[model samples]
Target: MDILVTGILLGGTYALIAMGLNLQYGVARIMNLANGEILVAGGYFAFIAYTATQLSPILTIFLVAPLAFALNSLIYRVMLQPLVNRAKSRGQLESDSILATFGLSFIGVGLMLSFFGGDYFSYSFMAVPVEVLGNTYGANRVLSFVMAVLICGALYLWLNRSRAGLSIRAIGTTPASARLVGIDVKALSAFTFALGGAVTAVGGALISTYLTLDASTGVVFTLKALIIVIMGGVGDVRGTIVAALLLGILETLVATLLDPGLTLAAAYVMFLGILLFRPQGLFGKKPT
Candidate 1:
């Protein structure tokens, strides 16, 4: 029971972490390697706000979201758009984006190291214990889970119910067909990319409450997000949430029954299995 509850709580945040990457890669068709850096930056913003102004880290979401959106939009326009325009095919664009964002990740890391130094940062926020199902858990973790669920729920609704979201889905489904239907693929792609960054940053803010983070740790998160996105169907919100939960449960079970150090190895083993057997993802349809 304890493991189940803890895993569910952990998976909730994981869902938020992966959802942004899903949007960027699935909708915008840009495989951003710097996504983890963006998430770390959001955590930094929350840390700064909490330390300097005594502001609640939760409230920092509002500050981080718009800032991340604007910066990401600028990044897409200045750095990625040219690549997008020049690529001869989707494969070429993906290759170019991987290289470009890989460099950007290094730059982001350097800037963070310069400003914050290479030290772990964490803050005591809502550290009180809360009783749940005959067990105790940190109040912050519970709150974070609740917030993640709400945010993901809202995003799902927006994507399924709104016209703009329909267009975004159309592009993700078939970009060429979307273009034929008069969708401004470039502009919308940029928007989706910026929105993905904002979502990722917000996830960082939620996570900072419970996780100790440093400048260089973003890569770990990026890989985790990528794994979740792939394990779930790309662009499939429902699949992302389910895959995250499964991963969370798997990690929890492994850490509790085996060695905590093996949790990451377990994740990799699962990822490998998925790739070998279900490259199209658990929920993704096989290509024709």
Candidate 2:
């Protein structure tokens, strides 16, 4: 029961980060390898705010989210937009963007290391424990999971019910068609990436309270999120959430029943098995 609860809460954090990656790669075709850095930056931002104000890091979400959005938007405008415009094919654009983001990741790592040094950062706030179904645990994980659900729910509603959401979906499905319909594809793309960054920041802030983090620490998370994104099918938000939950449960079970060191290996094995059997992912439609 403890493992089950922990896995669910942990999965929520993963889902939140994966959602951000989904928007960048699935919606905009930007293979942003630097996404993990953006996430960790958000944690650093929250830490700075907490240190200065002596407030709970949760309160810094509003500040960090927007900052992440702005930074990611700046990157897109200055470095990625030109590449997108010049690429002759979708494949070329994706390939070039991957390399560009890879370099950007290193830049982010360097900056973080230079300024923050190599030590792990953690907030000292204490969370009261909460009880559920005869299981009790720290409130921080519960809060993080709840927040993730709320954010994901709101995003789902926005995507399904709002005009802007429809535009985003349209662009994801058929960018050329969306452009023909008078949608400003470029502007919308920038907005989507900003939104992605903001979401990632929120997740980062939440997790910062739950785990130790450093500049280079986010790479593992980035890889995990990438796995979730691919497993859930690129750009498939709902599917990604489901995949995250399953992965989380699997990881928790493995960590408990076997050596914790094998958790990532278990996840990778699942990923490879999925790729071999269903490359389109569990919820994604088979590519034509």
Candidate 3:
């Protein structure tokens, strides 16, 4: 029962992470390798804020979100947006993004190592535990789960029900057509990327509270994000949530049943199996 509940909670968290990736890769049509770094950056911001200001963790979002948004905008303006200006498919542009993003990841890791050092760390200041269905869980974990769900829900509403959100999707699917209809593609892309970064910042703050983290956390998180996005499908929101949950549960079960190292390997193998059978992704639209 604990396993089941924990897995469900973890899956919800991964969904938050994946949804942030979706905004960039799915809606903005940018393959952002920096997605994970953005998450960690947010985490670090919260960490520093907690240490310096003694502010409540929940209040940290106000500062973290804006900083993350600005940093994301800078990254796009410098690295990604240039590749986007050239006429090319996602494959071509993503190739460049991969290299740039990986480089960014490496640099970020190096900087963190230089400044923060190599140490396994966690913050437990704002902890609160709760009981559900005769099961007990961390208050921080519950808060994290609730925050993830609320942010994702709000984002879905914005994208699906709001005019701006509809415009974001329309522009990504066919920018040429959207432009012909007078949508501001450049502004929209920046806005979407910033919004995605803000969401990731929230995820990052949750990470600081829930997991032991260091400079290398971003690298692993990025790979995990990749698995979720690929399994979920490129540019599919619903697919991402389902995929993150499935992977989250599967990973949890595997860790329980087998050696820890083998768990990731097994998950990758499962991912490959799914890709072989349904390359368009489970919830992805069939290619034309």
Candidate 4:
């Protein structure tokens, strides 16, 4: 029972992170290896804000989103845009993005280590324990879960209902067709990346309140997000959330029933099983 509750809370954070990746990699078809680094940057932004101003961390969370958006937009303009413009094929562009973003991740880690050092940082939430179904849990975890749901739900609505959202989806489906139809593919793509960054940053800020963070800690999150995104199928936003929660439950259950040290390995095992049985992903449609 305890594990289930805990896993649900953890799942909320994972969903946010994975959802952002789904928008960038799954929808845009851009393998952003630095997605995790961007998440870390968001956390660091909140951390810096809290430290410098001694303000409420919750307020700082709002601030991190725009900072992340701007940062990713800058990255898109400088590194990704030129490559995207010149690429001969989608396959080649995706390959290049993977390598380029992978290098960018390392750069992010190096810069963070230099400035923040290799130390773990966390914030005190001063939250009290709340009882749910006779089980006690931290209030902060509950808050994180609620926030994740609300934010993701709002995003889901925007994507399904808004005109700009339709444009984003159209580009993802067939960029050339979208372009011919008058959608500014490049501009919308950049906006999608920026939006992805903002979403990830919000997740990061929530995560900092939940875990001890270091410059290198975000790689684990990166892997987890990738796994969930793959499990949910590329570009399937709702599926990503569902998969993240399920993975979290499975990981927590395994850790509780077996050895805690096996949790990470268990997640990989699940990933492998999914790939072996459903290469198109759990929610992905079969390719013709």
Ranking by TM-score: 1, 2, 4, 3
Residues 87-192 of candidate 2 have per-residue lDDT tens digits of 9999999899999998999999999999999999987655688898899978888888898999888898898899999999899899999999999999999999
RMSD of 2: 1.2
- Sort by lDDT, best first: 1, 2, 4, 3
Provide the global lDDT of candidate 3 against the true structure: 0.79
Global lDDT of each candidate: 0.94, 0.88, 0.79, 0.86
Give, for candidate 1, the lowest lDDT window spanning 10 residues.
261-270
Cα-based TM-score, every candidate: 0.98, 0.97, 0.93, 0.96
lDDT of 4 at 54: 77
> Distance (Å) between predicted and true CA of 277, model 1?
1.5
- RMSD of model 3, in Å? 1.7
Which model, 1 or 3, shows the larger TM-score?
Answer: 1
Candidate 4 matches the true fold with a TM-score of: 0.96
* Model 4 agreement with the true structure over 98-178: per-residue lDDT tens digits: 899989999999999999999988877746899988999888788878889998999999999999888888887888899
Name the better of 2 and 3 by lDDT. Answer: 2
Q: Better model by TM-score, 1 or 2?
A: 1
Deviating ranges (above 4 Å) for candidate 4: none
Query: Which pairs of residues collide in candidate 1?
Result: none
How many collisions per candidate?
Answer: 0, 0, 2, 0
Q: In candidate 3, which residue ranges exceed 4 Å CA deviation? A: 87-89, 126-128
